[model samples]
Target: MTFKPLLQHFKEMKHYFIVVVLVFGVSFYLGWANSEQFSHFLKDQLEGLKSLSQSLSNKDNPQMWFFFIIFLNNAVKSVAIIFLGLPLGILPLFMLVANGMILGYVLSLQTHESTLSIVLKGILPHGIIEIPVILLACAYGLKLGMLVWKSAAQIFVPVANRTASAELKKVLTLTKPLIVIIVVLLLLAAIIESTLTYWLVHL
Candidate 1:
């Protein structure tokens, strides 16, 4: 499928993208500035990830395992958020906030390396593709959430079915193409994270 449809979806749903960005930005700042308040929760998350990492490391061809794990985790979650948004968009928002905060919290933590070093060596390599792709998925998810409300309103107001159907078509039409885009980019990102970023951080 052509990437143009996904780009078109972005154009139509720019507002949702803006809202996602704003929410993510504010949450990131909160996570960075008030990390202590979130430490109890964030630490648990980190611990779980660390456990997973250690287990994966023991496996033969750890890098290959990492690639599969990372790509599947991200891809499945990304797709889930799109449909999970059907319930007033709560899950996608939560995912956006949690992911954003996790990033910010990690960046804010003190370490032997400089902040720039951590960013350059740890995040930028994979995150450049991973971040935007995730955000794009969330924006569509948010749009779907908004449509859910509108659909509910129509039950009472009784507007033309065509208008409602078209609005839905506009969003649903992007699903396949968007999933393809997310999966493809995230695969590349997984490769980078597993190989390049892993190598850099270890060194």
Candidate 2:
């Protein structure tokens, strides 16, 4: 299969990448500002998850529901802009950064030496596909936001009115497939991560 679309997908996601980084920068600042509080929060969450996972090991447990919830929560945070319309850019970016930081901090809390192993084993399978898929979905939102901003600008500039129709059509066409493709890829990635990757890691 061609990696070109995947590469182009990354290229298109570049804008969101910058936005995500900036959001993380802000999170890092917050983290830096209140290190103790943040640290405590991370520790508590980690311990809570571990306990929850352990409890769910039994056949009768309902904690398995958490897996789906967590999965959807992760997916929604990345694609939240879709429903929010043009206003999604800032919030999605913020969510992305906060997610990365939270992930980084959580891994750190788990084990320093095994950090790399844990991340690779736990995240790589689904993350490789899922993260990009999420980014692409958000890109569609960004494209919409750009269109709206451009449309609003047309009120002041005659040139803005010149090609709005054509440009808007192109944007809509480009983004529609992006939403579908991303969702498909994400599901495939999640499957690989949950099954094959899980087995390999244990091996």
Candidate 3:
């Protein structure tokens, strides 16, 4: 894929980006706004990761906890996605923002050097695809929530007159494909992250 195309795609998903930014921004502001705190957190996480990586270097299988780790990670992601995708109007978005904040906070805790290593070892292996896939699902959830919001606005319409058949059809038409794509991507990531990544790291 052309770099330009990816950029354009991201450009079109400005809302998703914005939500992530707002969430991460608030997180950084609260947890690492101070230079000292940021630096300390960064150093700590880096050192911790470095130690862990070094320890794994001699392991016959570094991914001894592979299934457990991936399961935990997926569980967190799924729960967050579901909670944030709920059709409770903007509540899901708020949850999304909060999720972003927590991620940012954790990331900020890593030192740049360690962060780079972590990116390569912990993230890049599968995160290249996983992150985007999750974000797309989030966007779909956001879009779904928006539809529900619109439907809610018409709640006062007499029940007989307010047949939401058209709206339901519209949502399903747009959402079905999105759901399929997201699920496929998520599954692909899980496979890569769980199996391939485990072997690669251990090797």
Candidate 4:
């Protein structure tokens, strides 16, 4: 069997990826510009994160703990969005917007710090890979959502002829393998974030 590069196939759905980026960007801007409006929401979220961090901060192996936490968190959420997106893609969109907004809100709170410095010193090291992986997951999730919508339409109205099955067949060819790829990439990102990013941020 002749194998085609996944990149080439991914291009077939560039529109989904583009939409993901745009939605994330807009949500991020809103989070940054109107952070005051979301202060309570952000605080509640951060408290939960802080609790999780405290629970997981095993002194015996800090780096390993970081890796385990980051990887597991990203991997589970990333994979969940894809399948969870089946409901008209709402969950994926919500996740992306929420995640982006959370990031922006956090950065906005760091007003006394140089944002560029913080991003370069902290985020850029791993975000280069991590952020893209997440966006890609959200993109796939959005596509799955659309497919479900089409499927329903076809079921209720035969003339609607959405061909969701045929569309999904193409996607399925990549979905399983693609998830493995996402996991591997997120693993790499986790490693970088745990070690390299930690060093960079501390240094």
Give the runs in model 2 whose Cα sits over 4 Å from its true position: 1-80, 83-85, 160-166, 197-203
Models sorted by TM-score, best on top: 1, 4, 2, 3
Q: Pick the candidate with the highest TM-score.
A: 1
Clashes of 1: 0
Model 3 TM-score, 2 decimals: 0.58
C-alpha-based local distance difference test score of model 2: 0.59
Task: Write candidate 1's Cα lDDT for 125-183 as tens digits.
Answer: 99999998889888878888888888778888966573654687777877988898899
Q: Flag the better candidate by TM-score, 3 or 4.
A: 4
- Over 30-88, each residue of candidate 4 has an lDDT whose tens digit, in order, gives 78989999878877988898887777665677778989989999999998888888789
TM-score of each: 0.94, 0.65, 0.58, 0.91
lDDT of 2 by residue, 57-154 (tens): 55353333444544555555545565444652455554555555566675655566876887788878777777656555555566566666677677
Worst 10 residues of 2 by lDDT: 61-70
Predicted candidate 4: what Cα RMSD to the true structure? 2.0
Alpha carbon deviation, residue 120, candidate 1 (Å) = 0.5
Residues 1-203, model 3: lDDT tens digits: 22343334445558865675465457546544443545565556557646865675556664554444454555466435633664643654554554454445555668977767656776687877876665555664565566566567678655655435455455445554454555666667767776777666556
Q: How high is the lDDT of residue 84 in model 4?
A: 88
Runs with alpha carbons beyond 4 Å of true place in candidate 4:
1-5, 160-162
Q: Give stretches of model 1 more than 4 Å off.
A: 111-113, 160-162
RMSD, candidate 2, Å:
5.0
